[model samples]
Target: MEQTANKQTRLSQRVRSIQPSGIRRFFDLASKMDNVISLGVGEPDFVTPWNVREASISSLERGMTAYTANAGLLELRVAISDYMNNRFQVDYNPDNEVLVTVGASEAIDLGMRSIINPGDEVIIVEPTFVSYAPLVSMAGGVPVAVGTTAASHFEVLPEDIEAAITDKTKAIMICYPNNPTGATISRAKLEQIATIVKTHDLIVFSDEIYAELSYEKDHVCFSSLPAMKEQTIVINGFSKAFAMTGWRLGFVLAPPDLLDAMLKIHQYSLMCAPTMAQYGALEAMRNGMEDIEKMTLSYQQRRNFFVKTAKEIGLPCHKPDGAFYAFPSIAHTGWTSEEFAEKLLIEERVAVVPGSVFGKGGEGHIRCSYATSLVNLEEALKRIGRFLEAHDIRGN
Candidate 1:
């Protein structure tokens, strides 16, 4: 009976093939301990702006607790469209081209599943968000990783991307300012990539969840490039920039055909995004500019501090142009990425993620999020410095 039960309950090959999230593994470990200063997760420490929260509360009081249209509340979709145009220089018809989702994550998954077929190859630039490869694999597509190094500030080379392409190649996925590395691509380079995409006639999935958090230069939307709109799927959300991670609100912009395909999956699976969160997001879209500016400035300050401190502490780190992460090489310690992360967590009670989990070219590095308060960052840095000294890896 036991043997029969095991055989009948076998998991799907896709699910079995992927390992669990490395970020969540360390987070789970830290949750069990006391006084741990965690720089593991990329979530902001800020509260959702009062007005945004109040809008959602008001919706609940008004008894607005039901499902929205499968494409999301039309008002929210319109707001997202307007915001995209004004903020990122991108335009999409809210009527047919925009689809609100549970979060940027769901939008990405829908985009992948909507376009990818069995054996199709999607080029993934790494170290990137942990989800890109797994989601592609889950959608029955093959993930081809093209790694970038710190010497280039982790920016992908266009020639390398072109080399990775072939007949089976269907799409290319990119995130900037990237998670784990926090690197942003320049417009000249993006235009160069656009030429390659057009020449090869491929799709591009641009995950710009951190667009508002850029520290160096303004973000260049991939779809905003000339003639590239039809060939791109833009994935963005309010979670990171709006400090509304718990609200689970995100939206996508794609051509009408692709949008319709994703909507079909969303309707059957998710129905729509949460109703109250939609109202909250509506308010955020309308009056959230000041909040974004304030939060971004704070993050830039923290980024400056964290990068400087990481270098001073004997870890070689590149100053990231956007996002809140600092990827520092721990090669000097002669410890593998996992070993450095684990030992630091155990001895110093400071939690950071091992870079290897972010995929190719991530070895001998660790990702530290500077999204927490400056006070917490100061303390965490002190602990890290002490830990490094104990190991005789102090700065030069």
Candidate 2:
């Protein structure tokens, strides 16, 4: 009898090295339980706006099911270019510089694969996104995490970024209006960071999927900074800002050479983004500004209510300037972030993501997304209050 090959050994070492997402683990756990109030997932509670949905349906009616160009539909690319120019004062040649992707997630993967050589180090600002480091690792690059704390509202400092740079440092990945923490960087600070990147002669991958969601101030697009456009790869999509997560449409804006490299990877792997989604995204960019405003206002309202209620319940939460999350410190409970989250899920039926999963400096915090309905938010907050009181975890 022939000896069976070891299945574990057959798998790639890189695939085995990374663990499954911690956020998905909690989300899946909560999904299996009855009456569980989940604040774990970062998805919008709102559905795609009727106009945008209609556009996709219309495309289907027109029998527009064929594959688009490998670089995506030219019209959609034009719309994206126009949107960026009009809204953020950034310009890109749609034909050569923009590539529509499966999602912002795919754009990130492509960006890393395109630029990262073996052993190259990419600086990731964390407690930000979970996928950044793993993607870097998968691309044969090293992920160097630069942490930010709640005391500073989770801001990524220029000095910290500079300190982490080395001869191998090739790129820096930044997600502003950050996930989990909802922290945004100021233009002054970003300019400083831009200067550092230029001085170090490094590239930047700017994930601005949440750019349209800023509540307190206008978001500064990194690529718009003087002399920064050539060095920056901007990743964005219809998911977060337009409430089109299910559409799986995103785009990347970069210089022609870099875009050409990324497009080669995209063509071989994805071919193109969904054709119907492209039509829908075109409508969103052309006619969906009001829809974005409506959603942002709703998120801001929910954010305000959630932050206020969390503080009242003895959870010290920083008021988020953007996005739909409140990063509240659970330190007073005398529990690790995972411990508090797990116990709260079991005892209170309210599910939150452990802060530790977001990398270093995330301990003693729990990420609670305010993207659910007001009624759900209210019930979740009340249950959290009850759990804190029972554990005698009043704020210090």
Candidate 3:
């Protein structure tokens, strides 16, 4: 009787409704296979900078293992404030307007839960980060997806965003340089989107985790726009730029009232971000700009090489201007994204993410992360060419 009861335990409907990450599914498959060249997960191949790691080690040596204040170390917060102002032209007060969390992922969750109410709607521009919609749903907000096509370079249009807005709409969440696509919007385009948000009086969750990796031009911080600071929540972290993915340090910049609400949830749920990571982040904020520039230049070179080789090998892809991904159209293969991914992995030992898993406008494509070494990417693309040739799919 006890066994049966345990087996029949009810889970939250929200948890049951969402599917596991498609990116991870392929990553696991690749991990289990021999000689597989994976282009699936979007992690930087570089290790965290030595100085940042040293700072964390120094803290541990000093016996600083106690939990920080609920909002995180004020010194770290102050550094983040200065960094934002200097790098992105956005000013956030450190004392009451900034909150550091475990990672950008946690920051995103806090933002969603703090603002969402049951039956409220949040407009999500896709193909987008996978966590955006699910987090909104888990927060009791309806996720309304607004699709952007490859033809538009995957930049969400202001008209499309306006059309998606309803009386129930409460916020708009955007990521650029976007995950999986590496697309960036111009300052003018962001200004237009800002107008729509202002007109509708909706909140904006702007994820700028990849800001320092842009190749073509400088990234425009959404909160830096005129009159947008009060209405926008800026989510950023050291994971991408500083190659500090394992450090788990990220932060939020919002108005004091909005930040206070997020802090309440963060305080109760997490207490504060890891103390050592805070010290490391403070070091990163102060001295990691050079490391970011070096890593970004390497990624840009890899991107150029990968995109060029992909087109030469019959995979048509847009030249990504930012971030480290190349979303190539696989429509010519006459296979669904998942089908192509599976066959490619099985036949050629190259692992990539199926586009359909990223939501609307992703059906005929696959996302390839160039965050790995050029040697690995070259091998992967060469194998992909063989797969295409065997399938008799010709490039346009």
Candidate 4:
């Protein structure tokens, strides 16, 4: 027993230090329950467009199962390059500047591992995705969180980012059309952040996976800003907007040198993204704009109804500008986020992610995804309303 314990203790400290994802914990709990209405996972409810699906089926029928180059298929890379340039005004050289990965999740991990050295610090904007900080820590980097509040509509201000930087700070990771909070930064605000990056001489990992879903304004590609392309590593994928989450396809656009380093790590860990999924993504780039428009419109309508309903039920929600989540203040319920989520799950059969799980400044809130059907949203809202009434928290 002593020897077995010693062997287990020899595992990497880095792997042992991080906790399992808070979002996944609640998602699992919700999955085990009967008649649970889950707003915990941030996945779109729509299926992949039939055209894109058919492309993957055609690829399989044609026996295109063999791996392409270690980087990715040339045709897929070219398609992604053209898509980015045409849609976002960002140009990437398909031959050297783009790398397709297993998913945007892999791209994020690869970017950190390629850039970070032991003990380096990465500044993470909080009330964002759960994966950012853990991926940084796994890369032997320290994660310094800069919190964004609902009061500021969860925008990561330039000053806050500046304050978080230290001599050891190597990179800043940003996610816009943000998760959980659903906040987005304006073009002018992003330009201010770009200036800060230039002044600090730091690299940026911009996760624009939700870029196409922005309702009110076009998502300004961070790399498109003046002199920013070389310093910014843009990560995006087909999971959200194209409703291709199960396809597990994502890509990174970066300078050749950075792309080379990321490719080295990716080639070893993930030889290439799934061949069929790559084919699907290729089709999406070539012919899925109409599908994206339709999905975005549906999400916009859902966002409007969900936010309005939450406010009516006495939850002060910060209306999300992008993404399909509604971050509502649950402080008035006089319960911790976890407690509130637990009680709601048990009593009302509704599952929302506890805000505290998304790091600092996430306390006193709960993240409710509006990606499900309007019928589901209505039922969940009714259940939530009853829960609040039981607690004597009437709508204002």
Candidate 5:
């Protein structure tokens, strides 16, 4: 056989060097295996509420499936504005500050693209969402990852944020009521961040996708701060709270100039979020919040159970104040996070995401998602206990 030339095999170095998302690789593998109780995915397991589905059906029946304006359906944008005000104590004009995109995922990408110039630095606090770094790279920006440890309960400290800054630091991408760790900053801490961003005149992309799932106090919006509003872009969506992950509906709220640039990108890249999704999202805003509250209560119940059980199994646990994830340190288990996850899935049929998949800071931890049923959570914990015991790490 003739050898292929380097010329034929050439690809973009960025594409070649970048690793396939660790989270996605395991999820794809686990999904193909049977009897796996997967906690690997961070999405809600709940059904998209009935009313929202009905609205989508109604829209299709009424021929409302045609494309709307690039900014999104006016009624839905107005609904989003009203909902954010009633829920988060923030006031956005909706006209200039909001552009709907496909789920919070796309909004995050859009925000990154709008502000990033080639070689600009985007500081990201790690063990964060898998998308942030890759997306930043794709947008011709450099991603600076700041490590947060298990001892600090995975909250990004002001000092750490300060240390990661450089002349090229154009923005910071932050997700609160965080994904894998479920860590959150209190209002006082956010104020500290406000101070940093205000001092540096830095732009902030705050991903509050899990905002509604916060357990103790209601979620706070970065834009709620009068000073922060001008430099902040808020990315939120219906996926977590309304159980609408499949709907592909999310929106970006920003200052006018930023929103305009994002809309140009959106129009060119995706044109608009689905017309049917807009109608369904409008329904969710209008009447589906009680359903959201029910889901939050369920997740909180599961969180409480997982925390208690994880401790019983000798894991050092952090109580999550919001979101459905519980990140427990398994350093005592004599295994890396992925090793721990792999053993549990192979030996006992329970599935979870390794914390290291999130970033370097997550080396000794694993993310336990309580978005599954109570029965599953209990069974998974039992399997985890057995896995730990075999390693002589439980109940020492």
Candidate 6:
């Protein structure tokens, strides 16, 4: 027998310091419980439509499995270009300005990686997606979180934006039809942010994956601002709007030089998005507006029901103007968000994500995704009522 010396290989210091996403803990716990009605996830419950799936299947049959160029299939990029122009009035040169990514998730990661240098600060608005901070950290950037209140309907004020800026600040990270809050930036608001960004020469990383899902108004693209366009990277995908999450297809639009550099990074780091999904996205661009209309209408109906039911159940939810999430104040419950979430899962068999999981300002709130069936929504609200009443929580 050979004797071995003790040794260990440790992770990189950056990797070691980063913690796993807070969004997954509730999900892991909820999975083991029986008869649980969970609204804890951000993903839609819908399957990719038959046409989109058929397009993927057709690609498989044709054996287009090998890798294509790093920037993605030309036809898909062209489609993306046209799609943006038609919908958002932002024009991108598909050949030199767009790079397909693994998902909006990876698009976000790559977008930050391509921009930030060590110690540079990335401004993030809360409660935002959980991925932004870690990815910023990974790119050697410091995260500066600006917390918006429920009283403002979670809007990030321009004064607050101005206050959060430092000389180290490199970019503004924004997501709308925001994840946990369902809050969106209006045209005036987007312009205001763009003006500040232009004045400071700061880059804007705009994640508008939920653009098509807005119920109150049409989605605004920040890149549509001429002064902001040159310094902005618009990252969007076919996920939320078209119910194509697992398809893992997304694209980014940047200035010519940034697109060129990002394509090289994408080529080595991610290679290419799944080819079949690109074909499906091509179909989505061609004929999926109706599908978006259909899905958005359904989501809006569910959103209405949830806002009503949740407010009635002591959660004090606002009627979301966009995305299918209700960010409700649970202040009536003496328990903190995590505690409320834990007891609800164990006792009432209903699961909602603790808003605090998103970041600092989220403590007394909870995010309940309405991306589920109407029947399930009704049942979950009633169970939440039972849980609140049993715990002696008062309501409006």
Give the TM-score of each candidate.
0.98, 0.98, 0.98, 0.98, 0.96, 0.97
Off by over 4 Å in 6: 1-9
Which segments of model 4 are wrong by more than 4 Å?
1-4
lDDT score, candidate 4, position 132 = 92
lDDT of 6 by residue, 235-298 (tens): 8999898899888888899999878878778888878988888888888888888988999999
lDDT of 6 at 385: 86
User: What CA RMSD would candidate 4 show?
Assistant: 1.1
Point out where model 5 deviates above 4 Å: 1-10
Worst-scoring 10-residue span by lDDT in model 2: 1-10
Looking at candidate 1, the ten consecutive residues that score lowest on lDDT are 4-13
After superposition, the stretches of candidate 2 with alpha carbons farther than 4 Å from their true spots are 1-5
Q: Candidate 3, clashing residue pairs?
A: none
Cα lDDT tens digits for candidate 1, 1-396: 999878756978899888899888899988999999999978999999999999999999999999999999999999988998897888899999999999999999999999999999999999989999999999999999999998899999999999999999999999999998999999999999999999999999999999999987989999999999999999999999999999999999999999999999999999999999999999999999999999999999999998888778776889998988999888788888999999999999999999999995788789999999999999999999999989998644
* RMSD in Å for all candidates: 1.4, 1.5, 1.5, 1.1, 1.6, 2.4
CA shift of 363, model 5, Å: 0.9
lDDT (Cα atoms) of all candidates against the true structure: 0.93, 0.93, 0.92, 0.92, 0.87, 0.87
* Candidate 4 whole-model C-alpha lDDT, 0 to 1: 0.92
Candidate 2 lDDT for residue 110? 99
Clashes of each: 0, 0, 0, 0, 0, 0
The lDDT, on a scale of 0 to 1, for candidate 6 is 0.87
- The per-residue C-alpha lDDT of model 3 at residue 186 equals 87
What TM-score does model 1 achieve against the real structure? 0.98
